[model samples]
Target: MAETAALAVTPAGVATRRTVTGMLHSWDLSTGVDGPGTRFVAFLAGCPLRCLYCHNPDTRYLRDGGRTPAEEIVREAAKYTGFIHASGGGATVSGGEPLLQPLFTAELLHRFKHELGLHTALDTSGFLGGRATDALLADTDLVLLDIKSWDRALYRHLTGRELAPTLAFARRLADLGKEVWVRFVLVPHLTDAAENIEGVAAFTASLGNVARVDVLPFHKLGAAKWRALGLDFTLADTPAPTADQTAAARAVFAAHGLQTV
Candidate 1:
């Protein structure tokens, strides 16, 4: 019985436990949600922002994703180590706002790294950069930093928050040499203005540490999610960004010598 109990730990501490709250979604351990390439991703619960174009309306509320324990998630992910390794992918903790649940986010990433030997990435708006602890930074391998808009007014209008902190976070992360993929959603006239895109590209260029830039064309895929949540869809009539618009915007960043994905 003692030997049986000892055997249960497995290579990744399978018997050890950790706490988690809300839904933990996983996919090909190498591809990322942002594009193709298998990746094991956990969409955590809760967020502080109220973006007008948010598609993950189901993740906005802290309680919406439901409660889940961390150990169970780690154990389940452990089962796919071979898949993760084979696909040249790792694990990513994304969210309504993964930063909102930093403790859980850090803990999960640490387990994946130290226990499971997995490459880990964090997808966040960096809205809570200062609020995040050093411990969290120490364990994160990469960051997907989303800059909603260049203009503060437009930022507040779109995300219901200020833009300074996000920029500050970007700078700090760069200073620390953290690999970051800057994410900008092309939201038609809202975030697609030439001046706004210029400013955003300038900011990203200034960082000098950006690994790549991702121009995500805005879509209404999450509109139904907002409706389901009984929330007013402010951009309900806003048309999605066109391919030409996205390509044009991508050109702006390319002009700065930044690689686009």
Candidate 2:
């Protein structure tokens, strides 16, 4: 466990004092998938959703993670500063759902941007978007928001949560002019309905701040994790979207004049 009593700056550039700590699942380096260029992604613990195709079920609970100080994470990310900068990469605070711990998430974003001089991003389900303070959003260069489903009922069925919050958050981000990358999982016989995809695409396009849309194909990569966790992997038999299916989904977003990847 790590802890830090460091002064952090607000979006206004005013200094504030606080003791910041967070439950960390782990950290890794990745490119393209996370954000522009390469990135050092911190996978925080805990989440508010149980998406059927979640790849990291181990991060579902806060207690399952290690307590680490904000400074500790900053230090670790600093080690990659040169590489990240050279590659035009940055740092991303991701999670089971980052907004589940807004304060800790805010602190990390602040340090990643101000302290490490890295572009900062927040990857969240947007279910807890209300928790993210404006100051926090101010520090985030981009938001990787997951909009699980456009149909309300399917959303509830898929994530065991309502979709209203995510939509509301999207609207708010648009109002704030926040840069966003909307991510949707395309599952065969599940979220593959054209109307469902269109709903998401249309709504995302309506949000002027959205930079792009990611039509991720749903897969059973996390089935083994669910089995290990003694939880049912309902999507085990679900097939990944074929290349044509994926392209069609991307075309939906493209039709809305939004970039897809």
Candidate 3:
């Protein structure tokens, strides 16, 4: 499978605001996995990594979609503030990679946190984590950080990008005492190596601010997306990790004295 060409930033249909307007893709009213509770997920367009397992292949490009204003998005998400707050969930700015568009993502997060008083979370690969500003981290209440693979070489092979940027971002988040939930996808032969998992467990455990560790079992649910995009689904032959594998991973993290989910 070949990687995507280069990034292309689209500006058409963008909605302007006090700061910088954003080029948005779509939004979901509520869901459970994006954050703590029922989250109103805003799937922003544009990302730097080409992960083989990305479900939202459509969002990889920075093409224009339903480009709504950040304030407008916050207003729409605010409608469900009561329900989300009652359930302890809030709004999440997810992406291809939110950090790819640092200004717009930060603006959206800031409004969701201060204007609507909602708990804000950013679901990201952390590949573009260096783009994150201090203000953005401050507005974000939680980070659903995807640490793809522990081995630097494996990380590049798995995500088609360097691993140092993500590690730097994780260190910065920990230094700021930002709450984080480290997400690791368990693949069959490619990434389920015991040593690699141990490496990830060790690194995440070292971050004292990590509130939870979510060991995700790999799945081919995104094969259809790849087909639709005419892009290669590299993990089409990969099997999802079994329950026992997942349990064992959880045990590994638990042994490191880190909470697991």
Candidate 4:
């Protein structure tokens, strides 16, 4: 369980010794595709994986963004409570990887759930899912789990990480009956392999808590970011998956009795 901490904001506006603080990237007051309804999304900074198609490459570094108190973030979100609640919406903590700052994430979720009475969600790659504590999951209402690829080799090539940990986390979430929405990226010749899609769809279908699936079409939307960062944009020439291709990928999930969009 997370214990309450005594704290005060420092002269620099950083909250000191009060619970935990995370590098704050930015916030979106309203978003539809992140979770269920309209959501107040907090994009934290930092990630463990070097994903090739990452749009916000700037967030790859820990503390690249200003260090902010979770309390401050929740207090800000409290302002939108009325609109969010009325719309059957709530707050989501997304990130380069929220679990990378597990304590901050847990404290933020706990505060919002108890103090502001918000329906909290976590959007993660599940790479650092092992960092999540029971208290964290207890406060989370839903999980937007991103399973980038199914095949281990492809997964490694895509995100510079293994697939086992992600799968383990997903299985754990399912075992706990936590509501989850699975997200997958469809990249031509990379992740769009028929066998890969089938493997992912089948695995997700086997999970009891997955309520929906999102087959995201790959795009070069982030190529500029990669270029700006002086990082090689390997997928710079990769085109977005066609509608027919996306539909075909969805069909794989549908065959496994899962609804995808």
Q: Find the candidate with the highest TM-score and give its number.
A: 2
Residues 142-202 of candidate 3 have per-residue lDDT tens digits of 9999998899888999888998888888999999999999999888887788999899999
lDDT of 3 at 197: 88
Per residue, candidate 2 scores C-alpha lDDT tens digits across 1-261 of 322356788999999877699899999999999998899999989988988889999999887689888888899999999999999999999987878778889899999999999999999999999998999999999999999888999999999999998999999999999999999999999899999999999899988999999999988878889999999988888888999999999998999999999
Order of candidate numbers by TM-score, starting with the best = 2, 4, 3, 1
Q: In angstroms, how far off is 54's CA in candidate 4? A: 1.0
Which candidate model has the greater lDDT, 2 or 3? Answer: 2
Best by lDDT: 2
TM-score quality measure for candidate 2: 0.93
Q: Answer with 1 or 3, whichever has the higher TM-score.
A: 3
Say which prediction, candidate 2 or candidate 4, comes out ahead on lDDT. Answer: 2
lDDT of 1 by residue, 200-237 (tens): 99989988888899999889998888888789998889
Indicate the residue-level lDDT of 261 in model 2. Answer: 93
Q: For candidate 1, what's the RMSD?
A: 5.7
**Please, what is the TM-score per model?**
0.88, 0.93, 0.91, 0.92
Mark the regions of model 4 whose C-alpha exceeds 4 Å error after superposition.
1-17
CA-lDDT, candidates in order: 0.80, 0.90, 0.84, 0.86
